[model samples]
Target: MKKKVIVSVAATVISLSTVIPLNVTNPAPTEAQETQQQPRYMTRAEIPAQYKWKTDHIYSSKARWEADIKKAELLSGVFKKNYQGKLAKSAAILKKALEDYSTLSRIQDKAFVYANLNADVNLTNPDLQAALDRAEKMATAVSENTAWFSPEVVEIPTKQMNKYLQDKSLSAYKYVLSDIIRTKSHTLSQDQEELLAKLSPLSSTGSDVYSRLSTEIKFPKITDSDGKEVQLTQTNFISFMESKDRNVRKQAYEAYYGTLEKFKGSFAQSLSSHVQSHNIRADVRNYKSALEAALIPNDIPVKVYDQLIHSVKKGLPLMHRYMDLKKKMLGVDELHMYDIYTPIVDAEEKYISYEEAQKQVMEGLKPLGDDYAKILKEAFGGGWVDVYSTDDKKSGAYQWGAYDTHPYLLLNYQGTKGDVATIAHELGHAAHSYLSKKEQPYLTSGYATFTAEVASTLNENLLWNSEYKKAKTKAEKMRLLNQRLENFRTTLFRQTQFAEFEKAIHELEQKGESINAATLKKVYGEINKKYYGKRMAADEEIAMEWARIPHFYDHKFYVYQYATSFAASAALSKQLLQQGAPAVKRIKEKFLEAGGSSDPISILKGAGVDMSSSKPIDEAMTVFEETLNELEKLINEK
Candidate 1:
């Protein structure tokens, strides 16, 4: 039998793909120019009608949403009758109940999607809000009603379940039954399970409140580059960060973090409560740590996490070398934090328009083969993507979709070099989902977070490689290589630093230490110093950086996967590019095709990667070192 383990609430609530807190900075505009520029905000009707999904067909009115809610409420009775006390009976009934569950789930998903998409756009709309509220309640009810299936299946005598699985009619559910039996050790009593289920909403309230506060609360006024004061907000902070003037970047950083500092205690409390919730849930079940609990669901080995931190720590010198190169390229006497983002290339590439970005993404991804490229092209051409950033637009980017519909991507597309990379990154996810949905059963279509970043990062690596080869001059090549290294350092090293900080805090909590703002800052400062090494000054405010990361509040220890996935992708991309179609085919079949059908390790091993060894991480770091060498050569030659 598989080893017995308990899953924690953190494993469920703090999964990957949490929000990234980006500081937006709008360019300082002259009064005349400000008058000339059109308002950036778009009304619901003004938003291109094509971009909105045809939700009328799904639910024509609020009354329809209510009716569906009623139907969903009615499903509890159906589920109870069909699934309760019937697991010991014939296999046909079990199969029928599973089918029923899947069908009802599809309906629930559609209803929730319909309500959520509309409400997200117009948060103040009462009808949409009501629809969303109803949908959430219905979902919780369904979760509570279905909670018994796993425990009951596990409670069935193992011999009996195995015997049932051998029957011709029940063999299809062999994996499903096996998984249930494996979870027997973690299953709580019906009352305890119900109580936990009911507490979920309240437990999640801290994260919900943090989201509202962060996104909706007004920030203070700050002076811009021209010395004119303007109100700072999440929307405008991006433009500020990308400011051409160093003073502006510094000012923006101070102003933005100043706001977070003012509310640091609030943010700290929210995050601490979130971690505490995870600890409590993990303790209730039988898990060694929140990290172990988080890994159990996806069967990711703990060593993978350790390897990521260790390898990235070993690679920090390479990063510091890259940092030094950036300073030299910029011809600065001393590089400040503000100088890191300034264009390293004298003739930086122009921002690609959204249309051009789409074409470039397709061109860059062509090596993935025609069928995959074609689906991406269709997604780009179709209104599946909500492109472009606007005032009050959702911050950051994501690939979102219901299992039944074509994947939809929400991008805050500003026409920048990084924006082009973002396009490739998000479409990587879209293509992965598209392929998985087409290739696997609904049950297996959704992949765990571990493999999710591989596809996305692979596309990014491809785009960088394609762009690097096409550069005309040494400077251009250096610039492209610099950008690539910067991506690696930030996505891999910086995120690992975050992972380390998260682990430290959780361990502190586990040790019965109270987590407050001062403690968070001190711990974060130490981790930042350790990860970045002594080469660069670890700014005190960088400690407050923890408060700004939404991932910590929502996803505990999830950032490490970005480091691991990218490292694996870097290695995979190298194999595919140098070794040819056979390697590419192997990756597509073993990594992409396996989807969630197998454990992450098995899936990666099938793709010719063994995370148990340090080879992939070593290869990725070697790439970083090589790129650093190339940058050094370019500088010396210049």
Candidate 2:
């Protein structure tokens, strides 16, 4: 018999493409321009309609969304009645059952999308949050009803399953069926699967608690460089960290991390519980480790995860060299954590308006061909983006949508160069989803998390090159180069550090060790020390940094993809820059448009990057070393 495993619909929550949070800085307006330029909006209505997404595109009214929820719930009962025992009767019956299941899932997915998109824009609104709660309950019900699917399918006699697989009618679901069969050993009994699905709603308790605390916790005010007191906020903390004045950065860092420190106990509880849940699930599913449980569902090997940490650790000295360069450029006696974010070039930063950011993103992505250009134009004008930082809006950025609607992006776009890159990054996700939905069946429309970052990071790399080509001065080039190098630090090295920390915590839990605030801080601080090296001033606040990462609460084993995808994108972007149209053609056909029709590794290999080997990671580090070399040369020339 196949290994017993439970596949819950809750796993589908990751369809939303969220980028790892980066401390992107927005330029503060001068005092003289304060009256003319407001950096943030107090309400959604204060922003222009063009900058907001059309949530109505998904559902024209609340009544319509409610109707779909009811429709999905009703269909869930019908599905359980019709296909619960008849899945293996015949090839035609199996195909019909799968199609009906897809239809029901699509409706549930759409309803889930509407509630989440609304809740995200204004997390403070009770009505929206209530609606989101209802949507989650409905999704769990749908999952519970359809919980018999894989078990029954796996129970089909092997000879009969081979006949069904050979049927032309089931050709579209070929990969889907094969993957389900591949997990036969992991497929649990129908009763056990149903029970697990019933408990799926409880799985998100820790994540929900952390989300509320992170958004609701208030921080004290600090004096800005302009001598004006501004309240420290999650949205602007990064901006403060990037301030030209050392005192502003220091105050922001201390205030932010200090407040988080007060809530460390609660944060630690949330994280420990989250880790414990993964461990229990892994044990129940009979997996060797929580890491294996998380990776295997996505068809990712544990070795790939291990190799990322291994490769990144080998590249640590290069990161140290970059840090040493930062010390030299900033002329700091001690390179404290706060000093790391400020631009070392000492030049005034320019603000890029949302409209200007769109133009830059459009121009940057031009190499993807005219077909993609048309999609880009529609994505910009079709109201696919919700821009500007407004009160109660969610922090960070992501792209999400249903199969029936165009992809949508939620961004707190500040007029900064990094914000411009973010525009390109999120749009890459939107375009990938849009194309995949247009080309693939609903069952295969969503891509795996493993491959999600490839398009987004590739867009950023292209945007970097485009902006670099436009740089007219040494200072401008240096600033752009520094930003690129910073990407290597944050996206590649730093995320792997997070991945390592995540793995360590899960292992500790499996060993029956007690996990609390002190444990989390020690583990995170040690990892941070190794990655940043001895040059960084030892600060207790750095340990508290782990408390702020939302991904740890929401998604297990997710950060490593940022590192892996960066490596893959570096390889793909090189081909695009050098080979031009032919490379773009292959990437779209083999990668973006493939969706989840095949495993992530095979899809990427088809696109000309072999992630199974260390070549991509090694190549990416070489680029990082080369970038440091060029920057050093430019600095010496002066």
lDDT of the candidates, in the order given: 0.71, 0.84
Q: Model 1: how far is 72 from its true place, Å?
A: 2.7
lDDT of 2 by residue, 254-316 (tens): 999999999999999999889988998888888999999999988999999999999999999
Worst 10 residues of 1 by lDDT: 6-15
Report the CA-based lDDT of candidate 1 relative to the real structure: 0.71
- Relative to the unseen true structure, what is the C-alpha lDDT of residue 80 in candidate 1, on a scale of 0 to 100? 77
Candidate 2 runs further than 4 Å off: 1-38
Score every model by TM-score: 0.89, 0.95
Best by TM-score: 2
Candidate 2, run of 10 with poorest lDDT: 1-10
lDDT tens per residue, model 1, 1-638: 12111111111101111112222222243333344432243565665544443445455687777777778668866887767888778778777776676566656665666676666556556776777778888877877777666767777787888788898876655665665665566677766776777777776666766766677667777778788988777756756776776778778778778778988888888988989988888888788888877887667878888878887888887777777777777777776665666667665445455656777888888778777776675666555566644444455666655555566666666567787888888777777767666666545555777887887888899998888878998878877877887788778888899899888888999999999999999999888776665766556677788876767876667788888888888887778788878887888888876556677778888887777777888888888888888877787883
